[model samples]
Target chain A: MSAVLETRGLGHDYGSRKALDDVSLTLAPGEIVALLGPNGGGKSTLFRILSTVMDASRGEATIAGHDVRRAPADVRQALGVTFQAPSLDRKLTVRENLIHQGHLYGLRGPDLAKRVQVMLEAFGLTDRAGDYVETLSGGLARRADVAKSVLHRPRLLLLDEPSTGLDPAARRDLLRLLQRTRDESGTTCFLATHLFEEAEVCDRVAILDRGRLVALGRPADLVREVGGEVVKLTSDDPEGLAVAIRERFAMEAVVADGEVRMEREDGAALLTPLLAAFPDRILSATVARPGLSDVFFRRAGRAFEEGSDA
Target chain B: MRDQTWLPAFSLWQREMVRFVRQRSRVTGSLLTPVLFWLLFGAGYGGSFRPAGAPESSSFEYFLPGTVVLIVLFTAIFANISIIEDRREGFLQGVLVAPVSRLAIVMGKVLGGATLAILQAVLFLAVAVATRSAFSGGGPGPAGALEAAAALVLLSMGITALGFVFAWRVDSVQAFHGVMNLLLMPMWALSGALFPAAGAAPPIRVLMAINPTTYGLAMLRHGLGRDATGGPAPALAAAVTVGFAVLAVTAAVLVASKRRKTA
Candidate 1:
């Protein structure tokens, strides 16, 4: 299958700081790929480069077979972008914003009106068509932004933290709309998000840290590869307990923020041994299946929480 | 997409018009300053200055045409603030990522700004005609009115294009206003709009010579039953205004297209 969007050794720098360092990835048609990263892990830089909003210092990008640098207009035609911040004109109504967007893509007349209506209804925004976007809640404004991005039915959709600031309900609605766009239109979807729950919804996920792609695969596969399950132990001296567990079990233990964590093939089987090994030191213990968070921590040597300093 | 360029242009233009209509306070505020200038300046000097060859009309007669140009100037220059806001809001990025040509984007925005300028000019003209009938004792004829409107439209096109080019590089609203004031105030003051440019310092004359608004005001005066000033041919004034409009618009398109390539 042909890739809808591809980057070859893409690198970008902001002054002395490298925002995206030698990054390369591809999204095949009809696939949903989540870009899991910390705040400054180059997710926004990559999105901006892919959307043709900023130039890369080195390397190449192509969207739907058009070179991003050499033929930006063609690339722009093939891609749609939804930014983290809402971009809708506050003075215009939701329907008017969509219509104006349709014009930008060269759609008009009865056909344009029909497409606007379809998008409005599809995104559950039909009833608020005439309402000014500025008056809409944060969630509704985000919906309008999404509606504008896809008005042209672009082959590739790049969403940069689309669910930020959205309530849980709005986030779910937005995700459903995104899935529908992919399933119904077969458009490749590239999403950048810090939320693990959001990443879990994608078909595949790539974890980026400090401008590097540390891991990439299906979320479940990454979790399994990192180890089967994660066991957490909290104690007065987690560092000492972690060392003791590693020496006794011949397994690696990670000490993070005063918590002892380790991956085990089986949580229940490993917990009994762990408890017996350090009965007096262990204050509390919990075992659960390895998740995306654990996978991220295992690969980056730090929890995702530390990376959201922005 | 290939055949209906005007559809997009018109839609963008209509969007701007609707915005101006919705923000009626902004419209009134923008118009108020220039109208005040007309009242204060026109009344203060109503009896002092007279066109050497003017047909024995009141000083307000000549002031009315200059006031019209001032209104257009204020409207076009201040409309650029919206461009800064649009950039901050990411709306410009949304438009840039679309399939339309970059030229279309610049043209659409310029057209929108020009439309707003024209609306403000109409409002100012209506007020001028209503409150200062002495200025239009003979009443501008249909042909003269058409000529004046044409000159105003061309002036607006040039000003709006210049504003767009400036807006492309300015990221903040404060920076935009600073640059606009620096550029617009000098152009407005030295363009013979507020006072005659003749016999001014050589530097001021030199400044007026390059100013597109100078030609705009000259053409407008000729179209509004005032003396031609025997300075430049009417054809020359029209040509200069059209030439500036073309250059400003072309520069705007080039900047936008370059931004698209590097973005």
Candidate 2:
């Protein structure tokens, strides 16, 4: 079957800086694709292009068989977008926002009111439908934004960091809502997030770094791709120990945040070697299965810290 | 194809109108500013000024129509401020990304602003009649009232279109305000709003003749029996206003549509 959304060699630039470069992606119907990248990796730029907000400097994009550039109205009609920022009108009630959004998509009169009511109920906003959006909690507001996006029941839904400011419970509620939306509406979802937990929820994820696609696969497959169990060793002289371990065992190790992490089939075997090789210099050692953070580190050669550009 | 076309356009227009109604402050604040201008300025200058042609009327009577024009002008100019705010808040992006025509978005905004201006105009007229018995005493004859209504509608349409153009081209609020102030204050001053443009200096009169607001005010003055400049050439003035309105709205639609394509 044809993809619900696709981009070919997409690129965008801001004067001298490259926001998105030679990026390509596709999403199939009923699939939830998570785009994970470090800050400034061009995820937002890609999102903007796909949503028809920014024009790609070079490349072609299509939504449900319609060219984004040539038939933007069709693309827009086929998709729903929830921006990262709060777009709800603070002065208007939640129901009013939904109603206005419905009208924009050609739903009106009894039909408009019915859609608003359905959205309010689906998002658990029925009780607060009449309250001004400014009075809603952050989570409620975010949910309202999502509700607004889906009021027209587009074929594809694009959400940019939907979990940005929600609490743990709210985040879980949002994820559940997303899952329900996919199950009920069969709407292909493209979610952009920096949160690994959110990425893990997707059917598949594409890891990006510095405007480049580093890896793309199921989350479990990505974790497994980083290879064997990881053993982390900290020493007073981490760099020296890393070099010593590599020289003695011919194993690759990376030193970061005062710890030297290495991949091996048997983490315990490496632990003895590491202690024996470093002896007095070794302070602590721990071994565990690789997680998403380790996968990102191994692939990007850097830690996943906030605000650090790839 | 035409059916699909008009459906989204009408939907967008309806949405914009609903937004205007839901946000009562936007409508009320617009009316309040002009009423304040009338109350403060009209009271202060009520004793000194005399109508250039009608020596017997109070300054308030002479100033009423101009004040009403000022109300429409201020509301129309500031209406664009909401567009700037919508851009910043990303609501504009939401609308732009939807399955609606760019022209529909521009028309919706212009129509929305015009609707607000109309409501404000009615409120202002009502208040003007209530505050001063003279305004109510010989209120425009039925024909005159109808003509005034038509002129107000056309004036609002032109001003609203211009405002949408400003909002579309200028992405930042500060930039929108600066450009609007530079363009609007002079037009407001020279459009015979405060005094007759006929007696102004040669340069000022020339500038007024070129200002679109001057045509709007002239049309309005004729509706009130104070000037004959708009009656004989009503079509000419309308053509000028419509020409500018079309140009502004077209520019706005092009920019918005292009932004969406690239974005």
Give the fraction of reference interface contacts each candidate recovers: 0.66, 0.67
Candidate 1 local lDDT, B30-79, one digit each (tens): 67877787778767877876654455666666667777777777777667
lDDT of 1 at A13: 79
Candidate 1 ranges beyond 4 A from true positions = A233-251, A266-285, A308-310, B1-5, B48-57, B132-134, B228-233, B260-263
For candidate 1, the per-residue lDDT at A233 reads 89
lDDT of each: 0.81, 0.77
Model 2 residue B68 distance off true place after TM-score fit, in angstroms: 1.1
Number of clashes found in candidate 1: 2
Off by over 4 Å in 2: A233-241, A247-249, A257-259, A272-285, A306-310, B1-28, B51-56, B133-137, B228-235, B260-263
How well does candidate 2 match the true structure in TM-score terms?
0.91
Candidate 1's DockQ is 0.48
